[model samples]
Target: MSEFDVVGIGLNATDTLIIVPHFPSYAGKGPFTHEILSPGGQVASAMVTCAKLGLRTKYIGTVGDDERGRIQIESLQGSGINLDHVQQRKGCQNQSAYIIIDQSTGERTVFWQRPDCLRLDPSEIDESMIKSSRLLHIDGHDTPAMEKAARIAREHGIPVTVDVDTIYKGFERVLPYVDYLIASSEFPIQWTHQSDPLKALELIQEEYGIHCAAMTLGAHGTLARVAGKFHYSPAFVVNCVDTTGAGDVFHGGFCYGVLAGWEIQQVLDFSNAMAALNCTAIGARGGIADKEKALALMARADRRVMDEIQRRL
Candidate 1:
């Protein structure tokens, strides 16, 4: 068995969550109720989910020497994830997000910033980190660094899973190395210029020759093309309080399913269950459920909305 089940390389940020009664119109003022600092990011939050699910996880990324950086480090350390490869740059501001959450709807508006000082160069990724893990996960934030990691993982015969939301420059260089391309709904449409999501997925899968091409549809659940067949899994119903880390958690659950050798339908269903449960809390990672909790939700969850999506497929 591999020493680590999964290794993630990408971004991490400290978010300041401000709560207001309701989202006010532009130029309108409202009284804010509370504020809290939380640790979250695309790959970091996913790694946290993996750790919580009892996987041995490693995180490779960059942070600054600021207070937010310290907080982010502490959170990762507390989660028991290996962070030996996480670099801390001096005199730089750590990536930070000001997330304004509406108390009424539990939706958020974010303003985030990442300093150039924290960029991860390809030279910094060593072979040892890539070869030590059974699986590799990444986001498309730093294209060069991600490409380097993907190449190393491919060389070692390790599977690579990517969570891409936007079209990054030079992203094509990284796609060929990825075995699983799970992205947001907008990404496939934007990347292929195909209006139909299923067609977009097919085009991407055929072009990259990846094993699977999938996309997450916020409330509708998930859609994917696997083994030349289309599979759709609907999102579970839960009392949603905040949806900050739902997608990230979904990716983590999907990784778990892949590693466990579950069927494609099971994988999508399990991932949807995990993501839905995560929405019933405040922070991005606040609602990550344990195995029993997730299973319970899966067994007795409302998935009518998802059933409709499957009917369309």
Candidate 2:
């Protein structure tokens, strides 16, 4: 038996969320209603969600030795995640984002920075650390390191899931090792240069030999192509206070679904519910729900499928 259910190797960041009444016109000025410091990142936040779902989880990443870094460490530690592999770099600033959330629509615009000094080196990865887990979750950052980790998981016969929001240099090397890929809405189009998401998914899975190629449609839900079939899960309507961590939580929920052996449709529905619930609070993890809560939302909430989803259908 594996010591950990999900081992995440990737990035973590300390986010500064600025809540605004509405998104301002590009050149227009607006008053922000609130500011908050929150702990979040692609793989790190997903690991936290996995931990919350009672999975034995571990995180491997790099953070700067700064206040933001401290916050991230404390958050991960509190989530019952094993951070024994996390490295704190000396004299480097932690990854950060200034996210402007439009309260009116629960959408956000992000401005972020990640310094090179905190980049995880491929040499720092220990094969044993990844082999100890039953499943591997990773992000596209620190490309070479993740490529190594994914390959290690492949050799061990553990399934690898990747959450990538954008294109990364040398990402192609990592994709073939990925069994499941859940990316941002823009990623498929950007990576494949195909206008249609369905075609993009088909091309990715075909070329990479991945089992599943999926993308998250913010507010609309998720779309995926698995085993020559497409599944669409619509989002649940909620009183959203912040959209900052919705995608991170969604990936976490998806990891849970994968480990639990859920069907593709159920996986998307559960993940969408998890994401919608998280948006009901102030921070990235503010509304992370347990299985019971997520199920309840799935059973009772009204689903909102925007025109983007309708057009696809």
Candidate 3:
């Protein structure tokens, strides 16, 4: 039996959020109102959400031996995620992002950098890490390492969920091993060269033979293909803050839904609710709603935007 509910293998970062009154025009100057430091990353924040939702979570990745790395490690440790395999690379700068948030619209622009000095090689992944978890979560950053982790999970009959945004150089190699692929809305269209999102999803799922393929639409909610049908769930209305990490939290909520055996519609709604709630605050993992809050949004939230999605189906 697997010892953990989910094990995440991917990126983690410390974000420095600078709040400005409004997004300045190109080559224009603006006054910044606030500055805050937060711990977040694509896979790490998702794992934090999973742990908050009562899952036994594990994080496997690398961090630099720096203050930023220490902050991220401390946050993960406090979240109760197992970090036995988290490597602290000496003389390396940990992954970091400088996010500029416009207080006026609650939108953000990000600049991030990760040094190759902290890359995780495929050979570093061991059978024990894969076998110890019932489900595996990954991102496309370290392509080779993520591929190896997915391969190990597949061999152990464990489900693998991926959260991808950008098109990686060799991402095609990772698709065959992914069971649930929840990606950015643009990924499918770009990957399959299909103008229609529904067709893009179908083509990708058919080609890869994945169990389900889906994409997260920022304010529009999520769209998915399962059991030869398309499913759509609209984003819940909420007070906007910052959109960073919304997708990552959505993936974490979806992982919880899958573990709970939720149906497709409910899963999408739940994930959407979680993502919407996260936008009510700054930083990626901030404002992670509890089960009650998420359920409340799912049950009583408006679905006007979702109508378009339903029509597509």
Poorly placed runs, candidate 2 (over 4 Å): 306-313
Ranking of predictions according to TM-score: 3, 1, 2
The digit string of per-residue lDDT tens for model 3 on 266-307 reads: 999999999889999988999998888999988887763855
> Backbone clashes in each candidate structure, one number apiece?
1, 0, 0
The deviation in Å at residue 168 for candidate 3 is 0.8
Clashing pairs in 1: 234-306
User: Which 10-residue window of candidate 1 scores lowest in summed lDDT?
Assistant: 304-313
- What's model 3's lDDT at 264? 87
- The digit string of per-residue lDDT tens for model 1 on 33-116 reads 999999999999999999999999999999989999999999999999999999999999999999998878777888999999
Residue 162 displacement (Å), model 3: 0.2
How does each model score on TM-score? 0.97, 0.97, 0.98
> Model 1: residues >4 Å from true position, as ranges?
304-308
Candidate 3 Cα errors over 4 Å, as ranges = 304-308
